[model samples]
Target: MSLPKSRLLVIGCVWPEPNSSAAGSRMLQLLQFFLAENYKITFVTTSARSEFAVDLEKMNITSEVIKMNHPSFDEMLKRISPDLVLFDRFMTEEQFGWRVDEICPEAVKILDTEDLHFLRKTRIEAFKKNIPAEEIYFDADITKREIASIYRCDLSLIISEVEMKLLQKEFNIPQNLLHYLPFLLEPISEEEKLSLPAFKNRKDFISIGNFLHEPNWNAVLYLKEKIWPLIRQELPDAKLNIYGSYPSQKIWNLHNEKEGFIVQGRAENAEIVMKNAKVCLAPIQFGAGLKGKLIQAMQCGTPSITTAIGAEGIAGALDWNGFITNQPKDFAQKAVQLYSEENLWENSAENGFRIINSRFNKEAFQHKLSERLLNLIQNIATYRQKNFIGKMLQHHQHRSTYFMAKFIEEKEKR
Candidate 1:
């Protein structure tokens, strides 16, 4: 029997901006997956339009502008009455989740947590002081809020398996409530990969990520303060090209031609930059979730040397495409070695191709995800009944959010 096609409503924390963030690329992947499955998608965001926002019209995706902290959202959601509603992040879930529960009671609620904000925040706090994860966990206030958001949704899409286990062991969230879905991608064919610039053709060592992310900024600092000097001492002429969007003054100030460090902000084509780079370096001290820039590096047929934390939740049991080392001296040595050895670089590049195919194939994850959605739609009552914690949170949040929204509406009228 043919299953009925679903009408999906995705409430975004902000519009997808692939050029600006990993979060943006993640949203585009989700949109493409739904489009491939022939589902109708209506993406709604309360954020005002920006130059960075993805052009939905260019991609044939429907877009809607919503008002923040207003009853108008309820009316908007009711009029659409979608079969499934996806919240882009925890904050979006917090704002619109209650309204969806009230207006479209039967609709399946999915939380696409691009990455765990709480984990990222906690890690940043610890990194700033150079403390351990255990020390950071005790004081993480955002985790409580993010966890609450997880329980309120029918299913939360997690990008990292490490995070999946963390939620299970630390937070005690039910397995049914979480879905492990990494970056959805098509496997790069040998022919396609061959078309990429060879190791000899590529030049320099490069690292790129959205600078707004603390981890990327921190990684850059680690490279400058510790790694780059060692690398330059070994390979005197080797250059390090740093590319990303929205560089601050601090990031710009790091640019020094004599030192072989260049901060090239916002790649006209991110892949083009990666394709020409000999190696990607990410000496991340601390962070959460998968690093999209690393994935992009591999996609561009460029191998990388990253820390254990930088490679977290990415490769699983598979051998990393390149070296994974945390030591300052060891990281720099590998970067120099990988850049100069064509055979070594070629093998690592091949490993990258395998990693993406095995770990992130869109068809593999999408089919599993589709089945889970079908099961939820089929036995939603039974599923919700089993999730007593979700029910409690949903029930409580519904009352609290509704009254708070009502008060705001009344005040605005006066």
Candidate 2:
């Protein structure tokens, strides 16, 4: 017998690997949220993985592997007949949006845009050298595809409020189509804070991020080239350990155990390393959404010093757990000051805990999120009626993306 329509099909670009990337962590959290709301989740992915996959069996969630750039996914999706289909990112939607529209028209489609790819790319370009006016105005091909994917979906879960505003003020996307949702997290308990390794116990400076991301790789390069030299001149004994997953031979060559620069690849437990470290340095010149490393640092009671771009739209009105600086010399100086001063480090760390509790608490946002989802589902017809622009965009996408995907599918068969 066909199950009653209470299933959510989350089509991921890849399987969830909470330890490997922030995108993975966000996917797991969304699964948990729906689970709490009493919905069965079917997670579908195309990317193969060996290391660091979320245990779906443990969560009682069913997992399925779908073929990429193929029509087999349509058959798999049709068999499930989900009430709601959530696309993990814009690319996933671009690949499967038309198929979902055809196979499960009644299913409410949702796009979870892990982060705005165009924003990240634009920022990276600007940070590279002098940002040009034409560069900002330059047509980003990804934005068109992403925005079109959003139009095809019933709603999009936007991680960054800044992105939400940009979509509204700049692109003029209707408010009904976009919903702001950050990383929903449990507030750190007072007892948990007390149990964490204190500032005095933890020693040395650390910069940790996933190596797959270019921004992180660039940040590490910045530290090695510009920042570390200045920092070492002041604190000669201070050691800087770079921790991340997937360190290429290029990254490995930077390891100087003698000079107190160690490139430790793929930390078994990020929290363990974070807790043991006195300070986290994320001189990320450019990126979108929140930085998971910064959040983890806060969770582990380790203060961080990041760039203005690194700290973007994360803490809201709350004071940062550490300083934000762009200048290499100032950043290095602050690193020494934050590392040496116990009172400063403690205060900053406490501030981080407060930011997490206030900004990203799961319990705080879960009820509101559920209510929003319910509103979208219940009044979807009216919502769609009001969103004439989305309807027009969707109509055009059906003509454009539909034919494009069909062409690709046909070419693949040959």
Candidate number with greatest lDDT:
1
The TM-score leader among the candidates is: 1
Superposed by TM-score, candidate 2 places the C-alpha of residue 81 at a distance from the truth, in angstroms, of 0.2
Give each model's clash number: 0, 1
Can you list the residue pairs that collide in candidate 2?
185-362
Q: List, residue by residue over 1-414, the lDDT tens digit for candidate 1.
A: 222556889999888988777889999998887877677889889888878888898877788798876888878877788988999989988888888988899888889989888888888887778777667775677887799899888899999999999999987889999999999999999799989998778899898988988889989989999999999998999899999888999999999999999999988888888889889999988788889888998899999999998999888898888999999999988988898888999999998999999999988898888788778878889888888888888889888888998898889989
Give per-residue CA lDDT, model 2, range 81-172, as digits (tens): 88999999999887777778878888888999998877887777776767842376247777777877787788999988788988898788
Model 2 spans > 4 angstroms off: 1-5, 132-134, 411-414
TM-score of each: 0.96, 0.95
lDDT of each: 0.88, 0.86
- Candidate 2: worst-modelled 10 consecutive residues by lDDT: 129-138
